[model samples]
Target: MLNIKNLQVGLEEEDKQILKGVDLNIGEGEVHAIMGPNGSGKSTMSYVLAGKGGYEVTGGTATLNEVDLLEMEPEERAAAGLFLAFQYPVEIPGVGNMTFLRTAVNAQRKARGEDDLSAGEFLKVVRAKAKALKIDADMLKRPVNVGFSGGEKKRNEILQMAMLEPKMCVLDETDSGLDVDAMKLVAEGVNALRDGKRSFLVITHYQRLLDHIKPDVVHIMADGKIIKSGGPELALEVENNGYADLLAEVA
Candidate 1:
């Protein structure tokens, strides 16, 4: 479970605030879709939740279950079962995908006092998930996201999510730049992980992805605040009527 209250965030060295009094709560097994136009601070919320540096919490609090999330470091947050799938996954020129995943997996396991997987076991586990997601073995052996297509990058993120199996996932624009097939692959990966012990906060601009994921709740954010909350039907309404009426209502 995750809870945020009157949360305000801004650049650490600047006075400009990107998030203003944003509040949200997501519980286990629930898939919540956050739909908003560009510059609505949706991505900002994801970064802040993930404890990215340079984002200062000017007001309020965020917690995972009973733990104060804002007090932890980014790696600590990841170890605490929080995962953020970025809008644009960065490429690491020298880090092979398998190498990167092994390091991350082992680090989290170490933090939790769990035994790290042997290379053989890790390969077996991840290979199965990668096969399900249509990720070739060659991709896993190559540098992380380096020279990968947009679809490959998105699928790779899902692969990591599956391998990590976090309690909560924040998918920040995972649908962006994805082809229809890629979108379905990513959505399937997400749906396969959905269960009573997990939750997802899907931040996206369009409703197409929602068609596959079928979120339990839909939230419309504007001007750094969540101004409207609705069900799956609201996503269709936004697609038809656009955010103009919603913006007016929020105003």
Candidate 2:
């Protein structure tokens, strides 16, 4: 469902490139995990895919269902069914969670030329998803991520994913800072969203989260490129033996 070819990206003013000839493909109904150490450019890949600012696509192309994804704006990308769940969720002090979600959902809907959701209907659907994701109603009424625990923030991210129902989803270190219970909850949310028409690229450091949300393919990234790609066993190997062994082969 998604294709990234020889992707090279860097900051707007800097000559140094962060992503060097990166290539990846994610198909429908498949889950892919990307594991790497710090400064490996995994997050940069996510940001570039999502069309965030300050990053210039120096080379390569990314396509979604045969459409040029890199040509679209961030909001346009969302309308094209691309979702990225951030590793760090920013708290909006005054913006209520539900309000923010409604605006986002409606904006996407409007962009797609669909009718805006009524207040009652929007609440019903979002509430159902929140409940399934184990997110409380009061949390929805509160400001987005305001004073929320690490687990709560992660759950909120998953809840947004569930509500958005994107064609492609990227989870950037969703397992970070989460405890055992929160990790399970976050993984379950991902599992429940799994379907034949959707795809996911889950970026994580450890293999723990992969235990719950088993991926069809696992990739090891170093520097700016994906060096090794394999099955679920690859994640276990990384967990047990660490990336040192794999890095040697790739380097």
Candidate 3:
């Protein structure tokens, strides 16, 4: 459902090229994992696709279901069914979690020309989704990610993903700060959202997370571009023998 061809990006301020030429195609219901060393442009690809600022798309095209994603604003992209779970979820000190979620949901609905959910209806849905993610009522009532544990913040991100129900989910280093049990909880939450029509682009550095998510394809990225593509075993190879051999082969 997502296709990118010869995509190129550079920092707007520095004019430093990040994505040399990234080509990827993710089919419906497919889960793809991107594994790369630091500075490999994995997160850059996600940020650009999500329409975040500060990056210039210097070349190529990216489309979702044949829709030109590069032309849409960030909010428009979200409304068009692109969701990004950040590596570090920011804290909004004054905005209550539930309130923020409801506003965001309604805003996206409005953008799509759908009616907003009633207060009661929204409460019920948020509660159910939060419960599934093991987020308690107290947590939901607190400010978004404010004073939350690292794992809790990550879980909150997953909760947002569940509520938004985006067609293409981009998880950038979602496993960064969790312990084994917490990681399993987050992974279970992600697995629950997988269906025959939704696609996931899981960006992680290690194979441990892959042990839970089980991607259909694994890509090794280096020097701003994807150098190799393989099955789940590729992640295993990276886990067992760092990126040295892979990088050497590409070099």
* TM-scores, one per candidate: 0.98, 0.98, 0.98
How well is each residue in 111-212 modelled by candidate 3, as lDDT tens digits?
A: 999999999999999899899889999999999999999999999999999989999999999999899999999999999999979999999998999999
Candidate 1: pairs in clash? none
lDDT string, candidate 1, 180-214, tens digits: 98899999999999877899999998999999998
Name the TM-score of candidate 3.
0.98
By summed lDDT, the worst window of 10 consecutive residues in model 1 runs over 190-199
Clashes of 1: 0
Q: Write the per-residue lDDT of candidate 2 for residues 30-64, one digit (tens) a residue.
A: 99999998999999999999998999899999999
- Residue pairs in candidate 3 whose N, alpha carbon or C atoms collide under 3 angstroms: none
Higher-TM-score candidate of 1 and 2 = 1
Cα lDDT of candidate 2 equals 0.94
Error of 2 at 69 (Å): 1.3
